[model samples]
Target: LLWSSGDESRGAEQALFQTVAPFQTQVSEIERSRRMRGKRQNLA
Candidate 1:
């Protein structure tokens, strides 16, 4: 029973990670693009 409970928690944790991973990637990408644009403006 303890082993099964541990597995269930692990599965839930993995599901949460998969759900958030894409949003996290998108947020980072947006931040990176904004930084690049700022650099370009400075150059101009």
Candidate 2:
């Protein structure tokens, strides 16, 4: 019973991770672009 419960929790964790991973990548991409724009403005 304990092992089954552990597996259930792990499955839930994996599902959460899969969902959040894309959002994290998108946020990082946005931040990268923002930094590049800032640098360009500074240069100008």
Query: What is candidate 2's lDDT per residue for 1-44, written digit by digit as tens?
Result: 99999999999999999999999999999999999999999999
Stretches > 4 Å off in candidate 1? none
Residue lDDT tens for model 1, 1-44: 99999999999999999999999999999999999999999999
* Reference-based TM-score of each model: 0.98, 0.96
What is candidate 2's local distance difference test score?
1.00
In TM-score terms, candidate 2 sits at 0.96
Q: Give the whole-model CA lDDT for all candidates, comma-separated.
A: 1.00, 1.00
Worst 10 residues of 1 by lDDT: 1-10
lDDT of 1 at 29: 100
Off by over 4 Å in 2: none
